[model samples]
Target: MGLTVVAGMLVVVGIDVTAVQLARTQLWDAADSAALDAADRVDEDRVYAEGLHERVPVARAGVAEIAGRHLAEERRPHLVRSWSLGSRTGSPDGESAVVEVVGRVDLPIVGGVAEAFGGGVTVTVVSRARSQVR
Candidate 1:
């Protein structure tokens, strides 16, 4: 009986950890995708003017929209808490842009084993990429 209880507890812990890791992974992937998309649209001619028009905010919004649509289609419920796009500043050779995305996903174990220890769980992911403008 003692061993059985221990095994069951271990299983529960494993499941919770796995869930959290998976959530974090998904967040990172989304961030990467968003960053790349925005970087690709960067306008180099008028770095200040055109770049502002094709800023990280615009890219972040686009990514969020696409991610939301994807989650909905997969029947997953996740909310984006915050999203930010870093500035476009570099040398004359080239420029790099950064996009940061943050999201919160409700885990299945939140009310069960997870709440027993503390509260719910929230995952944060950040990704950065550098691309040369034409």
Candidate 2:
């Protein structure tokens, strides 16, 4: 009986861990897409005035807005019970777009248990993209 109980618990843990990994991967994909989209959207005014000699310039507000719109419009994974854009979702430099996505994973069995301790399993993914013109 003891062995059976231990085996079952282990199996549950394995499943929950797999779910977390899947959720993290999905979040990462979404963040990457958002970053790429934002990077492609250069400041048109800057480009028109300065011209992109080497790299395109990105505005922090524009990058955040674009990334937020992409994340809001993009399809989310079912494993991610809930998610939100992180504060780091903006351009670190004038030429790059950085996106951070934070999500809570839905565990099949131990979700409640984990939540009771510290709000369940949460995952964060960050992605960056840059555009250059030659």
Candidate 3:
């Protein structure tokens, strides 16, 4: 009976851990899509079509604007308690956008346990996508 109880407890832990992983993965996917969308906006497609330079630099304001639209869309379905965009900055190579996003995962089982501890896990992710004029 003792062994069975221990095994059952371990199984709950495993399931909770897996739920956390899945929630984190979903947040990551949202970040990836948002970053890519932002990067695409910052890209110099017109210049590329005109056979111009290879690297397209994204402006600071543009990054925020483009990333804002994508992030808004990303928030619709995910049951994050709350979310924030830490930063949207250009890469060192002057041809990419990096989006840093932080979201709270709200899985009931995990949330219940975390509530006992005063908090749930926050999943933070950074996603980058290159913007090439060529």
Candidate 4:
């Protein structure tokens, strides 16, 4: 009986592990896609300064707005809890958009209890990407 119980527990934990990893991947996907979409619409028709520098023309408002729109569309049904925009900045690093996505993965069987106790593990993922200028 003890061995059977241990095996069953292991199986459950294993499934949880897989679910967690997939959630992480999905979070990354959401970030990447939103960043890409924001970058795409950032600025397609714009002129750059006359200088020897690597700089990107940024459309800050549109970038954040577009990113939020994409996140709203891409939010997963169960895995995602809530998501929001973080910061949109441009510097030597790059003209980037930072998207933060949060989700919860309830533990197998005990998910409800775990959440009730202290809330299930909340995963907050922040993704960043640079925009290109034309």
Best by TM-score: 2
Off by over 4 Å in 1: 44-94, 113-119
Ranking by lDDT: 2, 3, 4, 1
Candidate 2, residues 55-125, lDDT tens digits: the string is 88987788889988998898889978787889998887789999999998778788777778875678999
> Any residue pairs clashing in model 4, and if so which?
none
Worst 10 residues of 3 by lDDT: 86-95
Residue-wise C-alpha lDDT for candidate 1, range 6-37, written one tens digit per residue: 99978877876777677677767766665555
Residue 6 Cα positional deviation in candidate 4, in Å, after optimal superposition? 1.8
What's the C-alpha lDDT at position 40 in model 2? 90
Off by over 4 Å in 3: 43-52, 75-79, 88-93
Which one wins by lDDT: 1 or 3?
3
Of 1 and 4, which scores higher on lDDT?
A: 4
For each candidate, the alpha-carbon lDDT, in order, equals: 0.50, 0.87, 0.68, 0.63
Please, what are the lDDT tens digits per residue for candidate 3 over residues 3-96?
9999998887787777768777777787788777767664455455654467565554566566667778765435567776765444445467
Q: TM-scores for all candidates?
A: 0.57, 0.90, 0.78, 0.71
The stretch of ten residues in a row with the least summed lDDT in candidate 2 is 111-120
Query: Judged by lDDT, which candidate is best?
Result: 2
Which residue pairs in model 2 clash with each other? none
